[model samples]
Target: MVSAWVVTKVAYVVISIAAGLIFFYVTSPLVKSEKKQPLEESVSLLINFVLYIWVGKILLNIDVFITDPLAILAYPSDSDAFYAATLLLFGNVIYKVKWKGLNIGTIMSSLAPVFLGSAFVYEFIEVVMNDSTLAWGHLGLLFLLLLFFLIFHERQSSVATAGGIFTAWSLGQLILTFYLPYTTLYGYMMTRWFLVLVFILSMTNLIQNKRLRS
Candidate 1:
């Protein structure tokens, strides 16, 4: 039997994801046909990523799982689990790109709008429903990112736009970490070093895309 708290968390996740898909469909520059494959791929990858996170959580709390497997469902995932899941997701992406001929840029492009929309809605709910003032700064940052992406996404290649959005988001969050008590991604605490690494990787992608074009 799932507790009300767990139910509420699941509801929030569902709402955010639905909002994101709707937002992407409404705002994306791509035509219906062009959008189809990327959208499908993004959703598939996201489901796998969530599964990875759940597996990470279970592994992190193996003792609790051994003692009471059902109780593990109620345990909140921590930053370490999130980080580990992220690494696994990255590995998955690399494997797909290498062996399956998946286009990393196309995947990132589709993911950008959905991520922004979901994050904004989630933070907005935190601020309004939960009365969390700390979420306001994140909300502001997401809004700016959405606006920036909207302005330039149509003008640039998908890879450049995705890279730019990610770079800006990482840099913005890195800056926010200094002012806010802590910065978070989907309620999990984000470390500064991780943000720095993301920033570097995003920039590298952006530069590589530019060079390829040149």
Candidate 2:
């Protein structure tokens, strides 16, 4: 049987994702016209992303899964699973862009709001439900990013805006890690070096987008 804690966590995830979808639709008008994806497409992508994460979890715990597939539901996923999911997601995106002729920029633009919105909701839940004070810092950071995106989204290119938000978020999380007792996102054990790498990648993407526009 699935544990109550697992059920609660899944409920939180569902709530967060719903919040993200609502946020995306509410803010759709502000997104760059050229980068806006259809609602169906965005939903499909999000579903696929969630599936990838589940697959990652299963793969990371293959031993347990092989022994008793039903038992897997009780196991919690960790940073390693997250990394695996991310890599798989990245590969899937690349494949879509290259062979399926999907617009990478549009995908990124469509995903940005949902990602931030979900993150904000998740952190808020952590603070309220779990009494995690550290989550407040992450909540504050996401709130500012969302506000900034709303304020300047109409004026900025979607890729640039997404890149900027990610860069800022990564840097903010990195700084928070120094003073906080644990990692921000899902309380996963993300190392400072990983955050730095994300920061660098986001900054690079932002710069490249600017140069392309110029």
Which candidate wins on TM-score? 1
Quick one: RMSD of model 1?
Answer: 1.5
| Alpha-carbon runs more than 4 Å astray in model 2 | 30-38
* Candidate 1 colliding pairs: none
- In Å, residue 123's CA in model 2 sits off its true spot by 0.9
State how far residue 44 of model 1 sits from its true place (Å): 0.5
Question: lDDT per residue, candidate 2, 1-214, as tens digits?
Answer: 3478777877887899889878888887654553245555668777776777779989988898998987775766678777777778778888989998987777777778888988899889999989987788889999999999898777888778889898998999899888887675754667788789889988998888888899
Per-residue lDDT tens digits of candidate 1, residues 113-198? Answer: 88999989988988888998899999999999999888888888968988998999999999999999998887889999999999
Q: For every model shown, what is its TM-score relative to the native structure? A: 0.95, 0.91
Off by over 4 Å in 1: none
Write down the lDDT of every candidate, Cα atoms only. 0.88, 0.81
